[model samples]
Target: MLPPPIPSQPNVAIPTSWPPSAYTYPPLLGNIQTPSVHPSGSAGTSFGYSQAHQQYAVQRQFWATKAYQSSVADTITLCFKILREVPGKPKGILVRNLTEGEPNVLASITPPGLRQLGIQRMETKLTAALRGLRVDWTRIPLREIVIWVDLAHQPPDIAYFHARCMTGKEPQPAPSFKKQTKAFELAFVIDSEYWEEIEQQLADDEVRSCSFSKISNRSSNGRRSSQHTLDGSTVDLESHARRPSPDQEDDFELDRASFNRNEDHSPVCAFSADLTRALKVSVTAPRTPPPSKRRIIYQSPNQDHLRDALLEGGSSYSQLWGQGPNSTSEQIQFFAINDCSLNDLLADRRFQGFVCDPANACMGSLVIEAGNYLGIGTFKTAEMGYLTLLHLTAGHLGPRANEPVAVKRMYKRRKTPTDANPGKWVLNRLTSADEHSKILMEANVLFWATSIMNFTYSFIYHFIQSSSERPPFEISEIRFVRAGVAIVHNQSTGPTTLKCSISRTYLIEERINEAKDGFYKFINNGSAVPLTMTRKDASELSEFLAFTQHVQFYKTKGAVYLSDLQGSMQLLTDPQIMTSPLIGEGAEIFGDGNVPSAFNSFPEQHCCKHICRWFELPELAASTDSDTRSVISNS
Candidate 1:
């Protein structure tokens, strides 16, 4: 039998004044005696402060202080925190109020009453409510929501419902029922529209009495506008933005020295102290080394011998190159290939790489585990179009022993023997060794291109920090996994031939409690344009990424830029370098993914946003027009 629904609390009057001025709760140290600040800024002895209580107080204070901002991203973060920290009784009321109009539906779906509903049930009810309002729950801009329920105090059915949500392949099993509490976190990408709706509802209910006109006037005087002129003058909203003149640029550089000297002591708003500290840390962080200028020396068999050995399953690359003695152990040897010879700004050692060395060319080796390995003993497989990823721990007895590594092999289908062709290796529609090499080449190019992208991003980061108009902006540092190609011997089939694979170093880290998702594609390979403004893309991180691309295009003089920007908050992979065909003898530089048309269409497709205008990057349309005129005159 289901429990009766809890009675709804009477509607409390909303606070009239904005920001609430101050919180009355004890300073977050629960049950422990500590000195607390009084209303007059005097310290007083207080007791009963615990870690959880402190966290709750601080979070509530943070929400109260910033709630008036009405930012979609901020609201989602605040609401998620409230749901996680609030007690069951209050949480039930909050959830009920959030889904007010659909109480009957919520009750029908979750009969155990709102307070007793499991995390999964609660999520379902919230989702249904949002959907009823014509909102897409998937697009809610919430990357993750972690819930911990004291199962010792809750019903068994609630725990079972929560455990059932973990039905698919999970990194870990559901918490044991023997434990007092159970916890789980879900990661996903969400849209911004839902949050906007929630924000509007929140404003209408709680902040209806606040004077928005007065707040706007105060904000206008204190805050910097994205469309402000280089001279810090206000511009008309509808005006066509113009690039800063060379003289203005010179003036900016001239102010750099003074800006840096006074930066540490600059007056900051009281509410922005946390932001200032973060900015300081990021600005002062040690820079990564640039790409190596030294030439890459190949110490293995030539391309022909290596390809033949792989296809025919004959001699190993070590034997062909006479590098090591012949061994019976089925070992895979990976040689690093560094073919990046671009003499661009990235070649300079003075410039720092973002989060990794752009010239990370190294070798690695892995031994194929014996026994029931062919029967998928411990290897987990995830198949993509061109590559098949195998997740397994390294068995090689070395520093990397027992370390997790993802092995990537080109997806191939074996062909049956025919009179003319015989048995051959094929990928997609291509069956030749040359075609195989082309695919491998494309992979190598992508790996190198990631480094180039990181380097360009680093350059832009430094530029923003050192600029006179240093906007209070932050770009999340993006690092790609260090990867290299490995040639594995066919151990299961008696090891006469070698197979090619890419080995990526993998590491597990704690998930950050932030609004950003695990992975996002900011831009696509087909176009230079960025993704549409969702709450995630509207963040400062996404804006900076788009700005970096703009700066790269401008600095390179229309030679090259990067697109297909996909990855997590601080780590990225598989980037496409968009190069202009008009440059460097008119050839495709970074592989087939490097659509030259993307570069040509950039001017038309790109709509400059806040960061671009703040950095005073050259307008692509203007530059293209000037280039066209020059070409016509020359003709």
Candidate 2:
């Protein structure tokens, strides 16, 4: 039988008011539905229950009354955001065990009757008396907004996380549940047109959701692909509206007519510390960020602007992302991608050969791993890990710092030692400075212009290794420029010291001229062992670590190019006249097909000591050359 209805006023007719269309609760308010009630024990009569009717007669009668409609319309609004936990907290999903006597997060705001029942809650609700107001979005202008939030505890380069050890991000293989505890806090309306911007975002979201379902239904495996596709599309759409890049529409077709190569959306994009630092720099020191949803900038020729340059130095580039002096405590800080993942940077073709001296060239191009947060595997020590070119970075691009970068793919992946460093090689033989020096001088002389330095190698390796001695493991980035530091690894847990000093910069023409001369000697003149590194390898490395801001690699006539945004992607050339270091008398190693006087005297050393220096360490150490016992033979 239908229950008796709640008592109503003498005039029980439904109300005609703005509350009906203004709020969502009580569903279709003021609808003229029959409100017959059956009397089981109420002061009013109730109708017998009809199974076919579905809804209760009493509920229908109660909602139909003008008094009931007024109550539901008083409901206020609230917002929420999904986020993940940072590192330095419990890792690998710590089981939740609520503490005893935990503070009552939600106060007792239920009705007088429900309050007596003593049911604790976590959400506080408030009632707002109604004031009839029209919400015509078209007529009303929108506003912009900037927001900031603070969470107590956090970790470096970790994302979607807060102080409570809760990571909103559900990485594959992690336990997930339907109901997630809310931990996000927000500060809104900081910018001028904040409201309008939010309204536009919401509108765009609605359109994308509607179209996403339609598009997915057409795919053969739409059901499984829906989630990623929708996410990728939503990000692209939002980026286009908010921060459009020049090459956002540039197409690079794969085998399929429309391949979903969403490389820009890697987990690295979600890194909080790195992004915050990038934004800080972008805004503080203004550099027009390359257009897109992708945050990385690759160095390319003036001909092709989308491509930014790669100046890498480190075998464990992945371990040191979004890092700074305070990176350890703050989970989400903005940072520069001076040492970006070569894999991510090189995903497109525009990445010309990672420029390094002929000496460190053996260290190879940037090693890239498109894994968690765009892992940049081991690179040569000759390359500097930190961004030497500070002016070019956009760390503080303000609120628009996270504008999705439009990365146009110009180059395909090429398999070479310079570019390939997967996640598995666990044993990296350490090379001594002397052996590396030999190679820098002999097989390659690029080392003279560029030198290598490792600050806290053991500190990093011990932290990242999964088990006993993985060749590539976690590395701790020491803030100071360490020189002649000693790393004594005793069971992977010990103190290490970094001894480094001030920094210095060199003229470009001088280095390149030496390179050209050495290049000719090694390739054209057919020297038994090429003059790679100069006498200043150590000093250059020390100075690079201690002082260089950023190493600018502007090719005189190189393979890559950069496109200008003002026009239709026109190629621009660097104005400087940088002669190859090998050509003129101004060159260090090779001047007019002549070896330096030191090489003339020290022929036995062959002026190629830098290359062999890196091999002295076990990871990069070489075995005895039984075939060529001459130590520097077989060239």
Candidate 3:
């Protein structure tokens, strides 16, 4: 039975010796009211404290660097290994953790000092270890490995070991005392035949050229003979059992679920009830929705499960973007929420001044302000969202100080909420997601499973519908997702994603300029659609081009280059541009030698039907000349 509540005591007057002084009323200004200022002369509410904001600024800088991220990825990848694949499950792999050091079976098998080696060197050793092992590569799926840290069971401290023994059953009392003593001595026994072979090899006159034999070999059958003693074989006794039959697999799944149901999850869960209570206690704290949808209630995942999921996903950063192998379903939703908050902040009127000071406009400030506006108190999830944004934004930037440059952040909704685009009450029309771009997938861009296929369809569709007198439609709007691109008569389409190798807007602008200077001048003045590119289009194009050039330069990949444009343009104006030193510089510096192959393949594709027909049009002399000129120049 629970104890009863205690009765309240009567109030009594206390002495005047208490530290807190009695409250006093402010001095009233009867007829002349004026604002009061502090003697220190510091102006209205200041958030300029450098030390408090330094961590966020530093984190942004660190994340911006490629070296830091690469190192972290390498370290995480090195922490685990694939044990084996479980049968009856296509995606399942039994993994063993190696981060906990030697007592972990995988750890004991690996050579010492591997961690001390550089990533490349370490990879070389790991590859050598697996070479010619005859293991089924398909069954052993390893994108990432979990690293468990358990302080209760410490790994062995010894540097070297000869053998390890493992069994499928738990230990019990020995049948006799003689059996116990016999087991101890047998465990330490060394095989004489294995040593003899090694000694003979060392004594050989042609040590470098001698053909080597296996230290030990097993027969085709699964069983071993008496001659094949413990020292004669490398048996992985600690390894998990092989794939189970279909019936066994079902039982295994049921066992796991029941075990979870019976388990006391509160203590093992990542966030306890106490934490949830504390989070709810803060009136101004941001509300973290449960790792589920259709409900406002909060729920925390078990700590062990969460850790295991992270390790399996390859990198924590990758997991935040929902790119990991084991990323949770709610991770994407959580990210979408943050993206909404970020979009709101960037689209806000106050962001203009903040972005101007790049030093103070790091993600931390974005998170802090976004949290305050959204009423989100969980900074950890906010931090993950910021990191995820930074990750996706790598090698990408905005044209202006503050803009939604990341393609993932650009989308349209109604200005005021109705049945359409529900939950998004307020919308910014000035953003990339204008009314026309809301249903991008339904537009001219026909998506396919592959980039080459999508481009082929787009090329043909444009070529067929395009007027011989007007400029050819520039291929725009490449989606990294389905690798789609739109081909239209005009440039009314919204921001093209960064996934495209070249800026379609820039190409369209260049084409328009070419049209104006050449015989296709009619398209400039009398055309139904405007030939010129708009400011918004130019800004988006510039950002895409900038990032593409950066990636191309760093990797020396001939995907796209700034020099390709100049070369193509100059060739039309001056045929000698092909022979000029500028052209030579383009070939050498920007790797233009690769461009011819790309151009050659475009005409051979089935998409060339309309363009081929357009080329045959001779009724309009100037139009034909311009089309031929553009084709020849591009080729």
Candidate 4:
């Protein structure tokens, strides 16, 4: 489409009679008042003594022409072509001509991609949409676009800001052969077609002094974010005072002026990185300083004095860890709702586990706690949308040398409401929070499950050293639920669930000798198990009727088979043990008649597909099995 021509000098004399009238500038663009270029020596609203009204009328005639509005409108049409491919994300569409016209406009991009999109096609940076966080190397035709946006300033040079998308800085070294692939890569470069589109815009606007022809090599490359040296990297940092290796106090105080506070200067943040190991450890007050993360801080004598004064004024700091007889498990404190910063907690070594939320539906308050998973259950809110099913850490129950201290995960949601996009409404565009990021934490401690996976492993190992410590029962078999929820009410109650349905599939069906390892592999081999657990309705269990709010276990297991319900339970309806039957025969809770009222185990098969869905695996499709629910009393 041809661009419309808008005159630079509008307030000029002309014939009184012309069909042209006042320009109707787009209100959406706020009157297009671009630093006013009014005619010489006269106010924008003025005219001559004799030809005043006539001159003004003629200027309006020129301003009201169809040519003026087309310039801005055409740029949008071209940019729109590229933005339409993103599934549900907001991308940026910006257009800038070289020397002729520096009139660059940035708008949010659209979705459904190239062919699926409903716009014209362009092959360069002129039109592009940011796809997945990490890109596939061979899929796109172009792999490198020189970026020019400044990361430090806002209205982030949108052109340069996102012109390139990738994660992590490339480690400085020759980009040589055989280096293992990192998390992401920068792809897609600005294309020549983009410049052509701008040329088209200038052609439409007659008054455009800057023409696309004059503009060549309009953009160049620059670093995105100014990065600082990591913890051990000795750059721009002060050397340690040659103090007597004995006056170790010098090692504890980090110099704040050396780096950026939230970014480079975070003393606690640098140390908390999961991948980075600290060479040394030290503690200081929160005001101590920010530098290498390897340093930590405690309430120093001076800090203690400050805390005391603050506490005297009734400050609301909930210091959970105090000097007490049973401080090991409960010492981790909970920061008040008013305090959201992890700066202090991150500095403390006790900040082992963090609880991001209390699993109620949709009230988005994120809570992080520091402690063991003793009584804590695993559940976290990853990015501000749906809740994730977190498997807590062994650190909570008990941490081991290398058994990932904690692990957290979220159930991936199949669909979400449009209203769920908070970033869009706030920033006036869609973002990652919109399409939704599918990842439960890779390894984070949120609930008791945290302890089960890590701590159980630790405890079991601890048991290995001294055979006397293993918790009594043989624990013949144990399964880590992919999406099972253990709902614990107040410390007084447990599993008081009434009605709920969770489907399952027999992922692995064959029974193996105790000698085999990796049942997941065995299951994938297509062998089948003949296990049977009865599915009962809500009313079948009598304990649920008597209890108020106990913890309910909604588990989604990888394998669905019949196994011995080894543990004996005191039943809700009778004194019989629940795994099997009479004195000799065991009666399980969900077993024949001994099943507790408050307890109902609706079993289901955990196929790869279902497991993928529960965890919201990005590569797999949603599981499709309806009417196949494993209820609590189905004999």
How would you encode candidate 1's per-residue C-alpha lDDT over 151-179 as one tens digit per residue?
Answer: 23345244223333323455656533221
| Candidate number achieving the greatest TM-score relative to the actual structure | 1
Q: Weakest 10 consecutive residues, lDDT, candidate 4?
A: 546-555
Candidate 2 residue lDDT tens string, 230-299: 2443122121112112122111111111112222222111122322232231112123443563477686
Looking at model 4, residue 493 earns an lDDT score of 48
Ranking by lDDT: 1, 3, 4, 2
TM-score of each: 0.36, 0.18, 0.16, 0.17
Candidate 4 Cα deviation (angstroms), residue 178: 54
- Residue 172, candidate 2: C-alpha displacement in angstroms: 59
Considering summed lDDT, which 10 consecutive residues are worst modelled in model 2?
564-573
Tens-digit lDDT track of model 3 for 509-576:
00112333221111111111222334454433333322322222211112222212211211110000
* Worst 10 contiguous positions by lDDT, candidate 3: 503-512
Model 2 CA lDDT for position 356: 26
The digit string of per-residue lDDT tens for model 4 on 115-230 reads 12222223332332221122232232322112322122324223321222323447945332221222111223224444344434333221111111111111111212121232
> Pick by lDDT: which candidate is best?
1
